[model samples]
Target: MSKKDTTYILNEIRNYLDKFNNASDEYYSFIKLSNELSELRTTIQRIELADASIPYINQLKKQYDAKEQAYIALYKYIKHGLISSWYETNKIIKDIGKISDADLSNKNKQMQYLNHYKTLLQENNNIIKPTLKERIAYSLSNLIRKR
Candidate 1:
């Protein structure tokens, strides 16, 4: 491979690694948030039992349940992002490894390789299918902002 082509692959790998790291960080955040929310729900349940006579306690319990479900859904979305990023990173490394053994000295061959690389990136982009929870969260956020 030419110097430029080698540089391109190296840069792509570096950027992909950064993305993978970020996704991992977000995944950790999601876990932390989920745990905290679980604790909050437990506390709420305890309170609901202690103050069962409160007139609005049932409504409060229902809202708390909805919030807990939303957090669980968000956790799923972040976990999905983490797993997909890891898979894509591994695939990128493998693809780059294969490139190192190929002949790319000819200009036409180099162009073909570049095109193939673009196609691979496109495929990776297409794999980020949003979960239903993610779509709903986005919709809710947008609705709130419209006020």
Candidate 2:
């Protein structure tokens, strides 16, 4: 798993906590699921329209399944009122961090692919439109290089 992917999730959860603190009805998990569902819906539609390969469709389906499970779990947790303050939010963040950390460690057990992916992203950004994506790519690359 990429740092960006996990960091995006963490930032999203933080946003939801902010919303909840402001008396919003939306929970972080719910918003996360909604965003995932929206993304998956678009991908699924595009794949179907293009008559994508079976293996790719199967892969998307597996991802959809995983997101569905996460949504359900989050729904139940929120339903039980697990979130109340920063204390509760930190616990939830730690749970997600643990899973993502484990995934990253296991991925690195084969070989650290972080630099390779970052390089590819930079190359793509160099060739593509210099929009927000490119700006983020540039910023993240700089941050990574600094470390």
lDDT of 2 by residue, 1-147 (tens): 566665654555566546556543547558978798889978988998999798998899889988988888877545434223333444444445444435645555321343333334345433423456544655576589799
Q: Residue 28 in candidate 2 has what lDDT? A: 55
lDDT of each: 0.64, 0.58
Checking candidate 2 for backbone clashes, the offending pairs are none
Give per-residue lDDT, candidate 2, residue 32.
70
Estimate the TM-score of every prediction: 0.53, 0.38
Question: Candidate 2, TM-score vs. the true structure?
Answer: 0.38
30-118: candidate 1 lDDT, tens digit per residue: 77777776776786778777876665666666766777787788776675565556456556656555554345334665545654664
- Cα lDDT over the full model 2: 0.58
Cα shift from native, residue 109, model 2 (Å): 56
